[model samples]
Target: MATPLSAERLLTALRDEGLTVHEYREWRTHNRNAKGPWGPVHGVMVHHTVTSGTEASVRLCYEGHSTLPGPLCHGVIDKAGEVHLVGHGRANHAGGGDGDVLAAVIAERELPPDNDADTDGNPHFYGFECVNLGDGQDPWPAAQLLAVERAAAALCRAHGWNHRSVIGHLEWQPGKIDPRGFTMDAMRDRVRKRLGVPPDGGGGAPEFEPFPGAAFFAPGRSSPIVTAMGHRLVAEDCGRYQVGPGPEWTSVDQESYAAWQRKLGFTGDDADGIPGETSWTRLKVPKS
Candidate 1:
């Protein structure tokens, strides 16, 4: 267990990670600690605001919605990679999630599927909301993505945690997916590479699936491949998904693939939704 990073220390840690942080209104004194306990933090939780535009997203995160209270998260990471500090202790992010996932985070091990929701996560995790449309096609710019990695890495470093200690909201709660464009696994890899440390016995290295060939994506079946391709589409700003890049193929997949082909300067029949070897290789589908 780790004590929550002090606001001062938090700022220092982020800066040490080479980030530009902006202190929002009354951030030092803003919190919801009076409503609950805010200690024994185990890890950082990453989220994406379904809203776009940095200023509005930051303000909304700071002032919250009618259903949720203000200071929705500890920080709002914008498209430029700048971090806007909103709250310190006990932000409103990370609601009830799988207790098993929390346990895995504490133990620094591979996480189990988050199928249950018996745990209230608001009190134990520091949360950061990335500015995005969360529509899978909104595009997570390199700057914003790096800021998230740094933010999570900063907290992990301060708490003596390895990359395993970081998690996405999707990894915690059931039926919730704020972050759509990137994989938490990829983000954790970013943290690992950034931190340049051992895995802290979090288990063996993860296996990445190489491109199985363009023929493998012919649909008629559900698998992690479709989801992986979808992630790559979103990353390349060719995403067309409104829901999940889930295991099964849908029109979203075709549309997203076609968009990617077009972006790559493919035209006419060459821009057909079906992926070719050249485009498939470029997608870099998480090595899978």
Candidate 2:
């Protein structure tokens, strides 16, 4: 059993794991804590939205159906690997689940078949509703699957839990078959491997470098990674220089990246010739 991480910490953890997160309106405050307890958390629960269209699915997860109330899950992982945070505590996603399953998760052991619904899982698990049709044929894109693995791994790393701490909705509850088209055990293996690779290149807890936010591109700061970003900018046909987007950052590189941002339709301060997080991520600059 573990205390729930604060909302701010959860966001930081996910980002540190290299997952793209988008905070929805009032997401920090959105939760089902008024109805029940939110902690003594044991694990992370993964689910499928049975829905298409990221925006609609995210909204639905944030605002549940009339019978169920709202704050269905903590986050909605979309097809493009973007995680839209919807709620923070005691979400409605995981209902009554098997006590045996909870025991297994807590022990970090192999899960037994979920044959009973005797435990309150909402208070025990962090939920992530991934967008999918649940039709079996709907594809799970590589990026989306990576997001799922990273999201789950980030939580497990935080709690010092192993792969067994991650489970699918179907694995936790009876009469529920969400998160189809992929095996939970396989996903856990992926999470396990991620946990082995330290974020800072040290064999310990992750110490990720900050994401290249807009502030990272402010004048006077220099990094060799700037050259990689310049190459990506040139490839995208946004280059605006006489020559050399060399190993150093220059006004030309900033202007070119800003033009790329404009091509992507950002305006005003957002497009003020600076590299913001979203645009920088979309650019996918290679590691230096």
Using lDDT, give the best candidate's number.
Answer: 1
Off by over 4 Å in 2: 197-288
Model 1 gets an lDDT of: 0.83
In candidate 2, what are the lDDT values of residues 152-244, reduced to their tens digit? 988876555667789999998898888999998789778867776322221233222235766677666778778667655664557676775
The TM-score obtained by model 2 is: 0.69
Clashing pairs in 2: none
Query: Which candidate comes out best when scored by TM-score?
Result: 1
